[model samples]
Target: MGIDLEKGGRIKKRNRTAPKSENPYLLLLVKLYRFLARRTNSSFNKTVLKRLYMSRNNQPPLGLGRLVKLSRKNADKIIVVVGKVLNDERLYHVPKMTVCCLKISDSARARIQKAGGEVLTFDQLALRSPKGSNCMLLRGPKHAREVYKHFAGVAVEGHVKPYVRNKERKLERARGRRPSRGFKRKPKKV
Candidate 1:
């Protein structure tokens, strides 16, 4: 299902054909709404709540201050999954970064050392940094590593390979839940 920018931006599509996973941005908006709901504790005006839910289709419900606060307070390991190849965006230019894994090979470590950055584990990142802060998360396989090589002072870590494997297992289990022919009961005549 497609999301329209208008119509108060609330979830407009509701059909069986809709995508299985929820939209990331929409999820963020829902989170924001939940936060507000908790803050107001049912005292918030109905109109305002409606507006909040409606506006979620196009943009985040909270401002930058809230975003920063939430990021700084909750995040420990930032794993950036680059949807596409990296570009000249300022995201990769930050001087310091906190990563979630330390699976870099010897050659990659050498590259990072030359760039004056160090790798850290997920635990380290969580103890040191917040969740959604400026800390950039670079994700992708070989392509992500290539992007890292282009930067002079970027730290890289975290192995999503295991995570993917785990996800596949879950999917397999879900698919294996169908009923066997022996479990079916014969229909009775009316």
Candidate 2:
């Protein structure tokens, strides 16, 4: 009826300006980042603010191993992740690190502290690096979930793991699974 009526009616734009989380702490972090993102001309603050607005699935948790590997080259800089930091049992050793994340697992926190590392929250990170200086931002594997594995396979590769309801030796492992059952389809390299 107003301005958009002449140009295809009201343009329906459904997007997240702020996080949907009702948590006070999350809200506080959002507020701080919003201010920082607006006041500061740094691209890092803008990136952080955009990531902060992502959903739970969008902001996947980073593993300790991945973090260690990624921050290896830039050891002196503070690692900033817009999601939770998780513990990886596969990684035997952990080095001293300065990490800033929204959430952290107890074991992960313990391991980091045990290694003489320091953990900082979003607010603390803002205080430390208001302009997001000397920081390396990282994210976890988004499609690491089991459900994604079923759908996220190359059909041309012939090595796709299809989703099946009943996984049993009598049925699932019968036809195109093993050579003994019949003949396993070998993946043809392209």
Candidate 3:
């Protein structure tokens, strides 16, 4: 007797019906988006709903500097982000525009308002643009985590980062990584 799965013990689909957070505010937003997604035919609403179900790690924060560059082309459209907006000190000058996001840092909010720009929440955005018209959706780089740099086989073999627990010189320069311990590796013939 054995158990056989339909997908051969592998499933690559999102199965979340709702967010895992019990935060009342977040739950309220989820409820609002759920209705909007069901009632409206706009794919934007569906996309927003899907992002709302993502975990905290998946909801990466955006920076003010990159945002300015992203909205440079379509400055009039409202910028939408499903994560926090952080202040980037590199951005000395801010531009006037409308932004809608889940969270905003103190400095970022101050800078935006000082530049004659307005910040909005998801609910307010829905009231203004029910169908998500004249809105540009953006997200932070999800693979920006340091662990991604340690991944191997996807790129150059020698470029993968190694975990070093000690700073001692003797601990390194040994075995497969060094030529003195054994036969040195050679590049493959082209």
Clashing pairs in 1: 75-130, 75-131, 76-126, 80-137, 101-157, 101-158
> Per-residue lDDT of 1-190 in model 2, one digit per residue for the tens?
2576644456586557889989889888889889998999999998998898899999999999999999999998999999999999999999999999999999999999999999999899888889988999999988776666556352334445677788899878887879998889776676
Query: Residues 27-66, candidate 3, lDDT per residue (tens digit)?
Result: 9999998999899999999999999999989999999999
Report backbone clashes per prediction.
6, 0, 0
Q: How far off is residue 47 in model 3, in Å?
A: 0.7
TM values, all candidates: 0.25, 0.79, 0.85
By descending TM-score, how would the candidates be arranged? 3, 2, 1
Using lDDT as the measure, the top candidate is 2
RMSD (Å) of each candidate, 1 decimal:
20.1, 4.2, 3.3
Which regions of candidate 1 fall more than 4 Å away from where they truly are?
Answer: 1-102, 141-190
| Whole-model alpha-carbon lDDT for candidate 2 | 0.89
Better of 2 and 3 by TM-score: 3
Best by TM-score: 3
Runs of candidate 3 exceeding 4 Å displacement: 1-12, 153-158, 183-190
